[model samples]
Target: MDGVLVDSETYWHRFEDEWVFAAAIEGGDPAHEEVTGMPYYEIYDYLDREYGTTVTKDEFVAAYQDRAESLYGEDVRLTEGIPALFDSLRAEGRPLAIVSSAPQSWIAIVRERFDLGPLDLVLSAEDIDEPGKPEPHIYERAAAELGAEPADCVVIEDSLNGIEAAVRAGAYTVAFRTTHNAELDLSRAEVVADGPEGLRRVFLGSE
Candidate 1:
């Protein structure tokens, strides 16, 4: 939900640059894409495995939680036309869900702030036992919970990891381009959408 449903990625990138990459990881500079779409705990684990973490797991998780409270509560804005898009999809009998690496609490903030739904499902990476994004498990679980096959789902994502996960789950993934990911490689997705309007066209069968 970070980049797709809400524009929280730029804030997260700022946090990562100011703290995570600069101070949390030891000696190696990690790219933002390397961990952006993974769960916070998984991100710490990945960093520890690749570059060694300077902080304890609890400390890292706490930092993220603290930042998220304000980020989602006040800083983030819903994607343009998202409410209308959801309404359009609902009108067509589409089952809407938010499948994200974010925990339920964070997703809750966005949903409540935007009055996002009456959704079919809201699955977080923390809700599943399997690994998070860049892996297929999360999206696979979302499809299943919605009583649909992966091939029948249309996944919208803005991160490389998210795109990879959706693609691996056999869904027709649409890479939602944001200010932060425009230059990143998103070709693995079935379609690349410039913004909310692009997404409306893709989902509503419009040009």
Candidate 2:
């Protein structure tokens, strides 16, 4: 949900800036927007190659998980209109799921706290047993779990990786510009909106 359904990019930013850019890699954080929807493992690998992390991949992974548990619930801020949107979707019985790069354990807490039980499914990078964003595996798994064809799904994403993943899965995609991620090109997405409130068009089928 970070940088997508909710405003948790900064939480991720803290994790990246501390563990990723500071402790692990000597280089400053990349824009990171292009990689937003990517899985943490893929992200760690990319940072290792591009920024030269001294820590082992496993060490980096552990550090991220530890910090993630601390940050998940407290720091996240929801995207505007998300509650109403979910309510509407639930009312219509349109199958919906949150397919994200965030760890499943962490997402569970947030989901429960937010009363997101109506979401028909929740698929994390962990569920796919594959790499994360930009790969389409997560969303593909989500569609399967929800018993929806890829073409029947509509993905709401925030970053380039999320958009690309949806496109690869053959689903309609809407990119939400919550953070300043315009630096990450998103021309491939079907729709780019100002925020979650702007996403009413998808449910209304006005787009």
Candidate 3:
């Protein structure tokens, strides 16, 4: 949802740099690479455990919640060509779903904002008891909900954790290249898409 469906990573990274790193943690640099795909509260936990944050957990969480209202409400835009891709896939009788680590509330914002309806399924990390991304449970759950085998699914993901989770779930994963994770290793994915155009080609069978 963050990077794959909506361009929310830029806002997230900016918030991380300004609030999480500058005001919360005292460090040389916040290892965003280490926590990019982590759940929000877990990000604070990670920072506190590794670098010691100046703010309390509640404060950190509150700040993020406040920012998220604006970020998802007004700041982010759906990835280019995604609506067309969705239409194309739907036309082919594909059971499309959004399997994301984002909370249901955040996902709802995107869904409602973009009128992304007729979704076969919408699975969030919060819906499951198991740990989020880099863990296969969520992806497995999504595939199950869609009445499909994991191996038969093609999951498009933009984060290392997302890619790992999809791959571990036995799905054919397509790693999406975005500014947020341009340098991250995506070798675990079955294929790598340079951008939205590349992503369209991947699904349209042109890549």
Candidate 4:
């Protein structure tokens, strides 16, 4: 839903570098990878245990919540041709979903703002009992909710954690190229799409 559906990764990284890392941590340079694709609240927990943060968990969560409205509402741009892709998939009776590490509220704002069309399901890692991304539970749950076999689902993901989760869930994973994760290794994915058109081809089975 983030890097794959919208150009929110840049803003998210900016916020992490400028606000979260700069304001919360002391000296060492922090890579966005340290927390990228994590649930916003989970990032705080990670930071608290790893590098130690200056803010309380409540403060960290609240700050992200406060920024989310503007981030999704104004800063992010929907990916080009995605609506067309969604239409094509829906026409084929595919049950589409946006399974993310984001909390439901954050996903809700983006869905409402972008008019993402009729998604069969919108899932959050928080909806499950286990920890978020890099874990297969959320993806497993999404497949369950969709009434589909996990091995039958094709998950398009742009983050390592997301790809790992999807793969572990026994789904076919397509690694998506995005500036945010462009340099990271994506060999675990079954396939890789280099652009929106590449993604479209994958969805349409043209490649």
Clashes of each: 0, 0, 0, 0
Which residue pairs clash within candidate 2? none
TM-scores, one per candidate:
0.98, 0.89, 0.93, 0.95
| Top model number, TM-score | 1
Q: Which stretches of candidate 3 lie over 4 Å from their true place?
A: none
What would the per-residue lDDT of candidate 1 be over residues 60-122, giving only the tens digit for each residue? 999999999999999999889999999988999999999999999999999999999999999
What tens-digit string does per-residue lDDT give for candidate 4 at 1-207? 989999888899889878898997655677876677778787888788888888888999899988888998889998888889999999999899999988888888888888986999999978888888787998899999999989999999888878888899999999999788889898999999987988988889773
* Root-mean-square deviation (CA) per prediction: 0.9, 2.2, 1.5, 1.4
lDDT of 2 by residue, 1-207 (tens): 778766777777666665577677767558667456787778778887787778888987887777777576676766777787878787887877878888789788778767777667877787666777788888888888877888888888877788888899999888777665755667788878766656887566542
- Give RMSD (Å) of candidate 1 vs. truth: 0.9
Model 2's alpha-carbon lDDT is 0.76
Candidate 3, lDDT over the whole model: 0.87
Pairs with steric clashes in candidate 4: none
lDDT of 3 by residue, 126-155 (tens): 898988878899989998998899999999
The number of the candidate with the highest lDDT is 1
Candidate 2, residue 18: CA error in Å?
A: 3.6
Evaluation by TM-score, superior candidate among 2 and 3: 3
